[model samples]
Target: MNSLNSPWAAHFIQTGAGNNQSFEQAGALTLENIKTLFAECDKPYSGLPPSALKKAIYSSDLSQVQPLEKVIEQTNRLIAKNSIMVQHPHCIAHLHTPPLISSVMAEFYIAALNQSMDSWDQASSATFLEQFIVDWLVQTFSLGADADGVFTSGGTQSNLMGLLLARDWFANTHSQHNIQQDGLPEYGHKMRIICSDKSHFTVQKSASLMGLGERAVVCVKTNQQGQMDIDELQQTIEALTAQDLLPIAVVATAGTTDHGAIDDLHGIVTLCRQYGLWSHIDGAYGGALMLSEKHKYRLKGIESADSVSVDFHKLFYQTISCGALLVKDKSNFSSLLYHADYLNREGDELPNLVDKSIATTKRFDALKMFMTLKSVGAQTLGEMYDKLIELSAQVADSVKENDHFELCCEPLLSTVLFRLSSHYQGSLSSGEFNQLHQTLRLQLLTSGDAVIAETKVNGKLYLKFTLLNPCLTLSDFDSLFAKIESHAKLLTNKAL
Candidate 1:
């Protein structure tokens, strides 16, 4: 049982548990198997009911290992049947996008080697590559030579990092205590963050995570265009100051979630500077506009921000969980630094990425962008995004022209907010219309004919077309709108 002489025995042990450096295999078998599995995923969705889908996945037992071929087949079935195919042209929901093929190809190597960005010793070249990518991002934001950044899982983590640093900076400069050493300062409840009402909910959620209660978040009013009203923000700040509350930071949205609204960055930044408050821009959805010469101006004050969150997965056409947090001054990252003797000792000169990120064992996702940039330069990506931004305006006009649909506002970015108007006068109330939109959205989702987004604005439910698919045309949206009308009409008839 313990014989080491046999080549087969050695191979089995090496492949199962030994480090790749000590015992590496070609991995050809698994790669070929996965390729075959991917070939089966042709449909946008599985079309299976919730219960049936659960049964398919949960029925498999983990007590014993199955044949590799059978496992591959099962995985193929899952990929083909159960996945939410973001690549589908009709999947204009959320900030999701069809990933660039080059980025997907880069994931193969990223997964194979399994590099971590936490320590320079572990990731080696990956660490430098990530830093290079971060530098490119800093340059893109025009944050100057002093700018620096770190990649994150996504917007949430980046937002958290931004708030965390801001929190620590507040504790250090405003008070005698250091939060990193002595915990949250006294009167922490008095600390507050200000942002537009349309900014992502992550701002409030992040405050809660940092021990600042949700009440610490102050929602400033936005204009009809969904941008943060600068006048209202100034008044709110003055009122907060009169109350003697600590204004820690002001979070600005480069693009609001529902309306794709871009707040006046210059306006917000001016106020932040005036108040001596940290400026953080949540550009998770609209950050990619920086690539476009035409649209980059939308994110004007983003370069002036102390911290910025950009999700490449959203507009860059990259896979999930690829985002970055950039800082105008590289030294501000010291708030996140806590040298680990065993990992990145004080004596070590090499860069330790963990000092700047919430995650330690991070994937080399920057490779996806690097590969994409190398294959088809940044200008091409910008052009693709410009195409969509232009399309969103056209789609909004289509909705306005259609008597059946009530357009929420002029299209700002790639999102068009609208709702189906009920013809029944006095019979259907605002609440009933809300229910109608909710019902229609669910109906369409269940049918899998199309996947769109929905959000409530001014207490009125509205449908959203978060169009990120560059290849999709106004005709595709027209077809989807037609289906919505047909579906809504059928529902209305049944009710009558």
Candidate 2:
């Protein structure tokens, strides 16, 4: 028999005729495994400890095929022991959320169909549906009829896309410099993207990737709450202009990482207009505020941004890796559009998604959001976010009342930053104080009863509560805080 035509080789091809029976069994088993794992998410740390995982992983044989029942049971057990239980109220770490059941169902379908979004031919109806979703998002931003966007991996990719288009458009608009073709023009080395010091680090990374050094990201001073100081930004722009440096874009962060501070969007956009700079908003965390009737006003000038990036996974309650980059004017995407004979041809009109995005062979992650909105409705999600925000405020109040803790700032969106105040009475230095807070975070993680993020503000360590779980209540937070304070005192006593 020919090697290619042999049953063994053909079964690996993934075509229905070759592997349909095997695929069906595997798919069913995987779904059942997921259900079993998800059922155990009430625990703070559902995963096994490091030592046990290492032992099991070393013993497992990948080369041998196991029975379907055995495989399913083993997979479910491994997942239950290893996965972070986001659904648990005490697991309020990072910007992660327990994905909605409706959206999880959508994810299963998205995976099963395996729709790729690069071109028209690969995902015919899916391509249009993605476009429809993009249109809906653009409308939500009130970005006008000419607005367009593409789904990305997450905030990082979306932010990269935002800056990439801005970089090219700025080059072309200013001096007819074709950034894509010319590599970097004479002054491209001096290209600057200004944003708050509190802005996400992705901006500086994007600058570095774009051949503009990290120094090209000029940091404007932020206020106590972390919003950019417009006066300082103006002064910095003037100083840079005096130095003959070119300003490519102004990246206004809608929600900062550590502080969750929303920069003055209207103020930032106004500056961009004056400086002839493209405005980009990294609304990755706070962008879901648009869904809220009560808080949509917070992002007042987001409509004026040249481009905006928002993540569905963060606050919009979708699963991981669902984000979009929206441009005010669809023509901005032309900078990235490329033509190929077999894929996105020049003459064809079937919505070639590859034209607007940096990625090819993209996942249909947008379907998760689409299904979420269709089933749960936007208002419902907004209310969920509002509830979390409210819960964060209660946590903040609890922190303030406790002498063992110090609130860093008022709760903005859903994140709360605070730190320990060990009454150790050992003439402790500030650096020692910082170390105690770090120890507190580590202790909690090792205990596996709670999960919370830790970040620094102004070179000082602070504990964080990123409350993306709407199901959590003040009682859950009370328990987590008690754990935190008790753990800190225990560490302090150990030091004594």
TM-scores, all models, native as reference: 0.92, 0.94
Model 2 off-target regions past 4 Å? 1-28, 46-55, 422-425
Candidate 2 local lDDT, 189-243, one digit each (tens): 7788998889899998998888898999999988778889999998988889889
Task: Give me the displacement of residue 379 in model 2, in angstroms.
Answer: 0.9
lDDT of 1 at 109: 81
Local distance difference test scores for all models: 0.84, 0.85
lDDT of 1 at 361: 89
Given candidate 2, what's the lDDT at residue 481? 81
Give the TM-score (vs. native) of candidate 1.
0.92
